[model samples]
Target: MERGNRIIYNQDGKIILQTGETTGDVSGHDTITELHYLDVEYGSIDYNKQHIESINPITKELVLKDIPVILTDEQKRLKALEEELSMLKEENKNRDSEIVNTAFEVVNMKLNNNI
Candidate 1:
């Protein structure tokens, strides 16, 4: 993944943090599953150990603003392709080894018949 991202904090940087092209791409505030979507996609996602909050002006209370955190369509598509290629490579290796083992078995059987 690229080093730089385009997300900005919402709610005076309070309610959510968003990036990419789509809405709520890197959501902050609450987390789900032992991980969140933001964790899966971004290199760094900062949150307080005790409490997580959004960014905003220091002096005043902030209201909710809608910002998007997104992974571009192209990026998502490329990631799928990479996964497919990796699986294909693993399958190819298995097939290649099968061929080699079969060939070795055939050679050994032929030698036994000759003996």
Candidate 2:
């Protein structure tokens, strides 16, 4: 009869498989004996808005404490360019609306004068 391997906990609460040394079934084991799975969902982090402040070893939870976003010079310049582009696009839209309104007013005036 073959004796199946049994799991045993060491004094440090580490799991050890009792496999005969002759069978060569024993391998290295992890020190973490108990790991509770968390059902929490983690969202994609925006480095500009959030930063990892610390991590809990036992729970393996990431602590995201809000702090001032650190950006490189190039990143700062790029952000400024994006803001400027948005403002310019808004101004262009307003100008186009104004031009359309002026054209309509001119057409109405011409119609009134002709009548």
Q: Which candidate number has the best TM-score?
A: 2
Model 1 gets an lDDT of: 0.57
lDDT for each residue of candidate 2 in 1-115, tens digit (9 for 90 to 100): 3344556766798976565433344454446666444344556777668787767877789788776768999999999999999999998998999999999999999999994
For residues 1-115, what per-residue lDDT tens digits would candidate 1 score against the true structure? 2233444444476635454343444443333334222222242333222222433445433333444457799989999999999999998998999999999999999999984
The positional error of residue 62 in candidate 2, measured at the CA in angstroms, is 4.8
- Candidate 2 residue 20 C-alpha distance from true site, Å: 24
lDDT of each: 0.57, 0.73
Candidate 1 wrongly placed segments (more than 4 Å): 1-51, 54-69, 99-115
**Model 2 C-alpha lDDT versus the unseen true structure:** 0.73
Quote each prediction's TM-score: 0.29, 0.37
Which runs of model 2 end up more than 4 angstroms from their true locations? Answer: 1-30, 42-80, 90-97
Least accurate 10 contiguous residues by lDDT in model 1? 43-52
